[model samples]
Target: MTARTPARTPRRTLRLPSWLPVDGYVLALLGTVGLAALLPASGAAAHVAEGAATGAVAFLFFLYGARLSTREALDGLRHWRLHLTVLGSTFLLFPLLGLAARGLVPTVLTPQLYSGFLFLCLVPSTIQSSIAFTSIARGNVPAAICAGSFSSLAGIVLTPLLAALLLGNSAGGLSADALLRIVLQLLVPFLAGQFLRRWVGGFLARHKKVLGYVDRGSILLVVYTAFSQGMVAGIRHLVTPARLGLLLAVEAVLLAAMLTLTWYGSRRLGFDRADRIAIQFAGSKKSLAAGLPMASVLFGPQASLAVLPLMLFHQMQLMVCAVLAKRRAHDGADTAETGGAPSVGRITPMTAPR
Candidate 1:
């Protein structure tokens, strides 16, 4: 018999470490910032870019209002306790810690960086990451979904108001006219979307993927506009490597505190493991997507500096939570193994961000 040719094994491509969950969108954001640093818009071009960013922000809110299911939000009200716990952690506890961080002002953090750090605390929890992490940990998926949606919806009105109350004049003039502009830019479009949802809901559902691109593109436009304005103002020189390092350290502590609080506090409140997982993921994180547009509206030209801490925190949370989610999943499997049950299945792959 003729000798059979040996079968060749396929070579595997190199991959990133599984522990690191680097998001592509975050990379896109970094690229946008770099582009702005290199080639910022000027004068008339700046005005045109600003106007487009405003329109894009409005369109983004409109999409949010359209896509969120009214009935589901209403149904979610039944889990009022869990929602309340999450809201308290996000709005109340976070701000308190931010206020306490004032001691670092002009020492560890510059005034501008501190302001951004405080602004980071005031922003709402993320919708996509909260639900995504909760599901990965085999937690209450529906509660996670509802909690994140509620936080996003609440943030439209709450974030600006909180910034007005907390950040005051430092947010680059949160005046009556600014408030009116915000209402027109963010609230009005959202309400309009809700009103027209009956007619456009099906279209939106059909074009879900397209709308997601719109979402990311709009945020990119906002980023470009804000950072371009900053470049024009020459604010980039304000942040040194030392200050950035300090800011990262402060944010790491803040993230750890919130994570511990959410996990332990939920247990103290008599929640089950599933609900605690949902609460921990939902309550402990801030929404960079929601914060960027709002900062552009509320802080105007100063938004670039104001959103810097938020951008950093977003990346940090994602990496930390990715590791946490996997650990939680593995623990569950271990418990099943000891109980004489079959090995638990792996976590479901996360859906792409909405």
Candidate 2:
């Protein structure tokens, strides 16, 4: 009765990294935009840079094709509901928002920038970040894979079509040449990558890091080119800091609104929590990859100005979504503690259309 050991103290700690929240990426993207504004590249060097960036974009997609496994792609196909949710958000929801925001022309945003805004709505959902945030939130990783793939695949066709139909005049009146350009320069190469995947897929997956460099480097070139054009054309004057801030605020509201609708709407539509999370993350993002090249091709000398809105929104979505994904994780800690997990995380790459 006399010998009683002192009770041990329990460690108290919070996992800071686990709580990074999707909004963090929004800030990061904003910072990136600010940096781009500060230095906005210029001159003939910019053209060379732009050429290099275009090459990079094709290569990046090729690597995307290589990294995806056929088996995983089939597995992802099994989760059709999740995929549709993302598609609905990308194609349906985003376009609606773009239409609603049209009243902002010449006040908060210019018509050309508004065209860029509309284009961002039509572009595909992001692949890497969508899968990544879904994984972090302990959501449906396979669903994320399929949903993201579906979005990208559909965007290749749908974006151009929807633009022609809804945003035809806005998108420079969609000439036969422009339609041909989408089919030839964009879709054709992507499909080619998918067909050749069997041969180089293994090599790509093994060397993803190296290829990622190729990807980032290419985007950098596009960035320089787009900015240089803007600098040459005096497009910056149209997008003052105040207007830029207003655009971000508008985009943030747009992002939050879409995320909320997709998440809760999916639940109401009878999707499970895991599927809802995947849908929300996958559906809400805009593909910077798709947007940049399409802008370059569609808007001509004004492509940079046309792409500026999207460039801003891309970073905004990433940062805001990053923070949101993490928050959802913490909020769902109780569910995790209850020992329920639909599946462990796994992200499969999507095939690029050649």
Candidate 3:
């Protein structure tokens, strides 16, 4: 018998499919969680990291306030209907759905995961991703900028108040002390940056790229501290593979509903295609940047688990919206090709601050 040739092993490569979207920031967050799992800070080191995380959170809001132009905010006021629609989808509709999702508990989700899911609903809409996606789809970029800014500003106050009313004891009891901490830590820094914008705006503008790194790094630090606390507290076991699968299924449904509502609802509300694009993007997504620090404050040692759903949803939205934006751009090209009026507006770079 002829000797059989030795079988060759298949080459393995580290690769993601072209259709699968993954943000670098999301990878950083996953790395931070891994670090927290392996090398969680404890004892005095934990305290120091916590303190630094607090400062990082404060600095993050400061950058937010500084980067968002007051003049742009005022200018966008003329588009009140679009802004109102986005806001309603964010605060009113989202919470109502979260309240409705209480039915999923015990069977579909653990009580703890449900609480995290609910908290995710109460968070503000994302600024950078919404702007980026809208711009990419040839949507109303200016309106997206203002709507995202407004949502963040409102969320600093509304999110905590809503969590108190909606989430109750799950959100660290939501006492006056909690609200006061939220205001002092988050609101005050944001307001300070807004107040100092005239003097520092030019500097921020000049170093936008550097400050972008700062923004992401601060968020990672916050994640590390919170997850470290959770690891130390042994709360990470609240999430199991089965429960995580259920949570993801639930979140997928929620995202699909919101996307449909934002798109169809905006069209029915008589918004043009450009404005609809902005509304769909701005209204459908939650802000992980805003949510993480707030979760750290609101959930305390339980924050790592609390923020997990938000983190997952954040990545899901980015991937889904990226695909949608590309499809939208292609549709606009098709319309132009057919000699029909181009439904979408001018093409711009996909870059936008998150």
lDDT of 3 at 273: 85
Which window of 10 residues has the lowest lDDT sum in candidate 1? 345-354
Q: Candidate 3 local accuracy as lDDT?
A: 0.88
Clashes of each: 0, 20, 2
Tens digit of per-residue lDDT, candidate 3, span 122-156:
99999889989988888898899889988988898
Each model's lDDT comes to 0.89, 0.72, 0.88
Model 1 Cα shift for residue 109 (angstroms)? 1.0
Q: Put down candidate 2 lDDT per residue, 182-247, tens digits, no spaces.
A: 666567777777888888777777887787666655565665566666667777677778877887
* TM per prediction: 0.94, 0.81, 0.92
Model 1: per-residue Cα lDDT over 1-354, one tens digit each: 999999999999987787787888989999999999999998999999999999999998898788888889999999999999999998999999999999998989998888899999999899899989888887888999999988888888887888888888877456779889889999999998888899999999999888788899999999999999999999779988988999999999999999999999999999988899899999999998899999999889998999999999999999899888878777767877788334435667573242
Better of 2 and 3 by TM-score: 3
In model 3, the runs with Cα more than 4 Å from the true position are 1-15, 343-354
The alpha-carbon lDDT assigned to residue 269 of candidate 2 equals 90
Residue 306 accuracy (lDDT) in model 2: 71
- Candidate 1 Cα outliers beyond 4 Å, as residue runs: 1-12, 172-174, 339-346, 351-354
